[model samples]
Target: MTTISAGATDPISPGVRHVKRPTPLRESVYEALTEMIIDGTLERGRHLVEVELAGMLGVSRQPVREALQRLNNEGWVDLRPGFGAMVHVPAEDEVDQLLAARAALESESARLAARHATKDDVARLKELCKVGTAYHEAGDIDGAVRTNGELHSLITQMSGNRFLVDFAAQVDRRVRWYYTPVAPVRGAASWREHNRLVKAIEVGDEDKAAQTMREHTEHTRKAYHDLQAGSTAEPATDPDPAPRTRRRRTT
Candidate 1:
């Protein structure tokens, strides 16, 4: 994340220009803590201590408290009166809902990309598909997942719908989190499906492209359920009720 001064003219990093200005302490704290939670730095179900977070981030406890409150509202943290805040453990139902939403969005993206994609665009998609396939074959599940996301994001951009792009961006991280458990299970076949989808797009078959995406995403949804059913440590059950924190009402 690069800082931007008043007269900055250099091209900002793609997809993160909003971080240029001096961010408020509370938002900064929230963003940092959110990343930690998403990236597994703060494991699910672990308690978050405001004092420790404040000291780590070089801020006062007030900012951490405010950030935790905001995170709670956003479903990333659960706040309890006596226990304070803890990372929200994502459950199977939540995962199903998010992936269902993703399937709807990406299937449309594939249809549109087939309608609008230039030769160069198709070539790029093929390139990413190859990279993901190579990564999966090389036993680099992390690299395969990252490149797979990049491929979907690029296809979404080809749809020429900024709203769809932004909406997909919003849920992208959560989708990644749910995908982790099933990546290896879905690895080779997933990339093969990607190849088939790209071929459909290359031929400008809108219906075929959309169907391919739908099937591909549906396969992922099934893979997730199967993985959860097979895993002993999966967070399959619903979470305990989140404790409510009292907020002082202000005029």
Candidate 2:
């Protein structure tokens, strides 16, 4: 027997209707705040006051507080007694490990997609690649990054492996977090690799597809390290400058 409580939803016309499932307000708030943090809208080190977040998200303070506590437990936010909450700046090791996990999962997805991809799947990937390439050329880094995530996610979908899909979903947001720093630096070369990957999947080359995806992910990982290095260390040069050529002619 199906029971609909009067409080379940707003009044509807006196006819049969399907009631959509309602998400818990706290969980919805958590997702919204986490997404803001992952996408850099909240930004690393940005203060998260409960009332401010509540007003911005159009939610009550209690839900926002609960969401912040959840983010804190997940290491996405730091809650302080007096200072409210702040977005946690990811450590180098944290981002590296996240990327490594992403690479492992996505490579499997690529391999499975290679064996399972239909012509339609390949065409969809190509269309997304075109859109991403256009965004990159137009200097819309955010748009390009979003399209890039979509292409990778579509590959996971084509894998037809439910477990892999679930695992990918777990890491998806954190991958975006690490990717944000290197998105502009990666630009066209990244999309070119995606094109190559799609071609491999289209041809049912599992080994090649997996290897390409692995290498493509490694590039992003390296780009992130390079970004960190640039910020913290001086650029390296030849340890020994070539012996100053004796200027015999000048003498």
Candidate 3:
């Protein structure tokens, strides 16, 4: 069995520590802080002072301290002695690991969904795809990301495998944080892939659905690499130097 530590103690003058209970104050503070971190209201590398955070959330220092510790464990916050805490920014290798894990779990879920999904399950997944695509097209990247997650959650539910679903959910939370900070290079492609997966499931092609889902996740990793490369490369201003021209003569 795995045991996780809760770093909670009595609040000390608006410093980061831990709290002991699930009081209303703690719950409220946790929710408020979580929303800020997830929504980019709290930016990466920005220091989180316990006192300021407590003031912002309108809670006592104890609850804020506890919430910070929880967020720290969840990969949303980075705690240090002098700095208190700051938003956790995932490294490139971390992103790769998350995408790899997501691909594994989701591919299996897609296979099971293809075999066992009911008509209602198909309908719900179709609805999620529609909403996700609409959000992507509307340039609401955050909403698209959320709806995309919902689509995956629905697939996991349809798979009837509780263990896989739980693991996928945990991986997804960290993946979202990583993906959101990067530009939305593959949002359209992602939704289209979702559509294809839905179609495969609707047709009850377990093999094709699983294969497509795996490829879709692999594509995300590729897109991330492309985005990173583009950020570092010099801007291109004109067409390729070796542009092809029509042949003028025939022998």
Candidate 4:
């Protein structure tokens, strides 16, 4: 675990981004915290202290409080009446539901992309694949994850369906949260799969694109489960663990 401290200058971390005061504080706080959660900087099941978060972002506690409430409403935070907020530890069933949803949505997107993609769109995908493969070979996990997201997002955009793009956006972060841990394990093979998907779309082979994407997502799902099986500590469970902190009741 990285030692989180105040007034830190770092490119990437949980709360290293000190919100510039010019922006709307609450919304900025919300976005910052959400990014942290999605990127696994703030791991699931970790307690979130408002003061600490404020110190991290160099903001007042009020904005942090508001952001946590919003996160709770959106299912990213678990806010108990007595307990403070904890990053929501997703249940195994919830992970399955979201991953399954991703597979369905992305497969359809691939099919539609094959039908709608132009030469420029295919060029963009090949570029992403090139950069992504370089990152993977260089052992830059974070770079690989970022490029992987760009590639998938480009495919979704190429689908030419606004609704599909909107739907894919909703699940994108959660999908990244699940995908990050298993990325190294998937390694070069994942890029190979992406190349196959790209080829299918490039050739306007709708069925092949759809099927390739489905298999690619399924491979990620299998990797996640295999990781869980091998690990002694499971991050997710059938039923989520209870919130870890409790506020004291004062008379």
Candidate 5:
């Protein structure tokens, strides 16, 4: 004897589609403000005035206030009792932890992508790589950073693990935030590394893909630290005795 659940195996849905719902004003405002922060439009430690933001975004002050409160809870903004709201400057430990988590997740994504990526997926990655390379070569740091995020996201999608994708999504925006400033420093070399990663996935070499991704992420991490060090270091009046040549990047 066997039991069958109702609607079980209800002929596989005909097409891939998702229902759409209208977003709440507060949520939309939150997302918009978050983007402004992530892309450096808002800048670290920038004061967030409700009325000004509302006017800029063509929204009411209430939603802006709500969004700021939410951002404060999420550590994206600092809301002082009487001083008002300002973007929270990320501490060194915060950036390191987030980037470390990203490295682990993306390295695994590269491994899984090598195992699961279809021919079409590889082709698409190649196309994106070409576009990213063009952006890098043109000295368009914003375009390159945007494409870099896309390429990594595509690799995670190719992993075919929904859980991994969800986890990656959590850190993706912050990663973009940290990456934006270093994009110019990474230059064309970053795209060249991406090409290597794509080739590994295309060949279905899981170990190689994982290793490549790990090294690639490490380079970015190091570059970020280097940039931060340079920013904080006192200006030198004397020429450096050891001026190391920087490796050029593509995207």
Candidate 6:
């Protein structure tokens, strides 16, 4: 029996060995880091160190730095002069403004979709709803958020208006950052509302679709407010133990 070379692992080829190609560092880093920020894994106010992130992602510092800069430009991170980059935390008012804008854009999108959506568009909406419901049931809140966004995106595209589609896409990204963190707690009710919205679109009911879209966004805003209030009302815990008074040892 002939002995195989050390690098030859594949049975089909005598000399050819499987080679693992290195994934492009910047592309991988961008997606991995962005997903963490979007899903709240990175968390607000958390500082990002390029070295640490690069090491974690199995990449070099250059890619991490580039990714951070891109994130900063997108409002996902803030780079300070003295301190390193920190996750951008939206203020309450900022969140409110985002939701208000989403309400207006999406309401119009729903109306246009109701008027122009073909049978295929309605079927696609139903499929998206089913996928979103499955993800919600599985406790995969992030998955639900992504699929739900797709449903809305499809409707906006089917509206046959390019300008409205572009505006809605930009606003939707901000809406997603808020929704993903809060969805698991409100998944059930949200999915039910999505089903109702889908039905309205399917029947070509413009008024009903627009109204439902507005109400849906309003419900999300209410949930966000309640969550914020509950968090603020919770008692804060001291990180350190209380200091005890020292007794005199040399009396």
Model 2 off-target regions past 4 Å? 1-18, 231-251
Q: Which candidate is the best by TM-score?
A: 5
User: Candidates' lDDT values, in order?
Assistant: 0.82, 0.84, 0.76, 0.86, 0.85, 0.80
lDDT of 5: 0.85
How does model 1 score by TM-score?
Answer: 0.76
lDDT of 5 at 224: 77
Better of 1 and 5 by lDDT: 5
Best first by TM-score, ranked: 5, 2, 4, 6, 3, 1
Candidate 3 overall Cα lDDT vs. reference? Answer: 0.76
Which residue pairs collide, candidate 3? Answer: 8-18, 8-19, 9-18
lDDT of 1 at 72: 96
The 10 consecutive residues of candidate 6 with the worst lDDT sum are 242-251
Off by over 4 Å in 3: 1-23, 228-251
User: By summed lDDT, which 10 consecutive residues of candidate 2 come out lowest?
Assistant: 242-251
**Can you write out model 5's per-residue Cα lDDT over 22-93, one digit (the tens) per residue?**
999999999999999988899998988999999989999999999999999988999999999999998878
Q: After TM-score superposition, what is the CA distance of residue 40 in candidate 3 from its true location, in Å?
A: 1.4
Task: Provide TM-scores for the models.
Answer: 0.76, 0.82, 0.77, 0.81, 0.83, 0.78
Error of 2 at 176 (Å): 0.8
The lDDT, on a scale of 0 to 1, for candidate 2 is 0.84
- Per model, how many backbone clashes are there? 0, 0, 3, 1, 6, 0
- Evaluated at residue 41, the lDDT of candidate 3 is 82
The alpha-carbon RMSD values of the candidates against the true structure, listed in the order shown, are: 13.0, 9.4, 12.6, 15.4, 8.2, 14.0
